[model samples]
Target chain A: MFGPFRLTNPLSGGLLWKIPWRLSRHQKYRQRERLRKVDSIVATLDTALARQGESMRKLVRWKAEMPTEEEMLPKDKYTVFDRKVKRYRKAIHKLPKWTRVSQRLNPPGF
Target chain B: MPYFRITLMRSGIGLPEKTQGVLKALGLRKRMTTVYHPVTSSVAGQIMRIKELVDVKEVGTALNKKQMREARRPAPGYYVERRGTAELEPPQ
Candidate 1:
């Protein structure tokens, strides 16, 4: 039943209101790029400190904890290992500040 | 002493108050604002807390506010070949 008083296209309905469970290909690509950028920044800091014959323990731990971009599998890159989710995993983009924060590592054997 | 050159790259909007407080403690009030502190365990811990939002580098020396500002300032496009009119030779 088309309402005579309404002036709207049905196609416009639900066009942009959905939050997809999974990320788009473009989002995945960008996420990977962001991870690499963070990595390089850390490496730069490390090398700079190395030149000064000093280092931070936290940086050393971070390097050991997180996997590099090349080290990550596509599955792990697009999704993070989570224990609470039904299948023990969730899309990385589901996390808050996903683009701005680093969440590359998961608990052991998750 | 070596220093940590920390530059805030992301806004702390929607984050926890404690996190925002850390940003303030580091003197990072706005995005792209940089502050330098001597490289120490305490400063490193502060950095670890907000690593996701900053770009850090270690330098041999720390830069004060004025030095950092001067470093960012661009070279003057025009120089005085002869001093300005007020200081120029009088009526000659």
Candidate 2:
């Protein structure tokens, strides 16, 4: 009878036996801590952008030391910056977002 | 128990409604929404339904969206422990 069963079977591995394995690899313990760190950094950037508002453009130009792109952006939320050029472009986008929140930050200005 | 790290590589768009529904149910709204679920028959079925649209790998623990994103992001590889700007300032 498999009534109200909680079967425990030791799992076997295929490859990569060098790496340690876990038994009850639940999300609550292992993942949440790493997620919290990433979320905090992104939220910090978002807050900085929200406070800077319109002055964000000049701030980005200063940090990047480059002219801003005049073209309109596509309607995509995710952008991967693989090179220094793309990083500059993405910094242009992040400027407004970071500056808008930067105004509220009392940190020593750069 | 190992969890599966499912990343949607191809879009489920223009696919059958049932297949699309499976993707939606997995919290995969776009081409790269990586979701983690415990290794169970139900999750397996979901993955099997849209297997062609995704790249699956079994990990020891489930990784959240942010953690997964950070994991895939390349390292910055540099840090500043001291500032030279203060050294340039005039003495009071």
Candidate 3:
């Protein structure tokens, strides 16, 4: 036989006591996450720059050894040949202006 | 609170009048019309009412009415940096 000192409903408010604490901890967790993202971005950018420098060096060596397009491509009789040449000339004409604008908008290493 | 992105995937034709009414209430005049609304129990309940006819997803913020309308518009693809001053100014 058991003696009951107090009577209470099985459902109680204590179940949700940690909700506010969890909410504030989650907020702190999000802040820490944002800072971690910024740190990762900086590290990634540094590694990217290093890779770009190495690639540029290889590009310079390849350009010195590569044959010119005129030397590589043979002139054969084809229906679209004339049209291709005209398009190539037009592209070459626009190249200077394109280079100038591209340089201004997106500088080297960007 | 976040916003909900609701897009009508299917039509409410031949369904019950109440279901069609819910679609009309959502301002979905036609298929593939996207609308943004703040996430609330009432809105959620309305979506549930016609859940079969639409797709729903939660977004960070609800777009303004004009922006929501513009969201469905196609891109112009080209821009004019300069135009004739006479054309820009209205004729006297």
Output the number of the TM-score-best candidate: 1
Per-residue lDDT over A1-110 for candidate 1, one digit per residue giving the tens place of the 0 to 100 score: 35665645544575654568999999988888888877877786667666756688888998887789889878788888877899898998888878777777677677
Candidate 1 residue-wise lDDT, B12-77, digit = tens = 998889899999999999999989888666777787778778988877888888998899899999
Candidate 2 local accuracy as lDDT?
Answer: 0.49
Per-residue C-alpha lDDT of model 3 across residues B17-38, encoded as one tens digit per residue: 8888988998888899888776
Better of 1 and 3 by TM-score: 1
Per-residue lDDT of model 2, residues A1-97, tens digit only:
3545544232243443342222124422323333233334333333334443312443344335421122212211112132455222232223333
Q: On residues B7-51, what C-alpha lDDT tens digit does candidate 2 reach at each position?
A: 787787776789889988988999887888765556655765665
TM-score (0 to 1) of chain B for each candidate: 0.78, 0.77, 0.70
True contacts kept of 2: 0.00
Worst 10 residues of 2 chain A by lDDT: A98-107
Model 2 RMSD in angstroms: 26.1
Residue pairs in collision within model 1: none
Candidate 1 lDDT for residue B26: 90
Among all windows of ten consecutive residues in candidate 1 chain B, which has the lowest summed lDDT?
A: B83-92
The TM-score of candidate 1's chain A against the true chain A comes to 0.78
Q: If you score just chain A, what TM-score does every candidate get?
A: 0.78, 0.27, 0.27
Query: Which is the better candidate, 1 or 2, if ranked by lDDT?
Result: 1
Task: Give one clash count per candidate, in the order shown.
Answer: 0, 18, 0
lDDT of 3 by residue, A1-110 (tens): 23473433423434443323112445434434433333333233333334434223332342364333233322110111223454322221123322111111111231
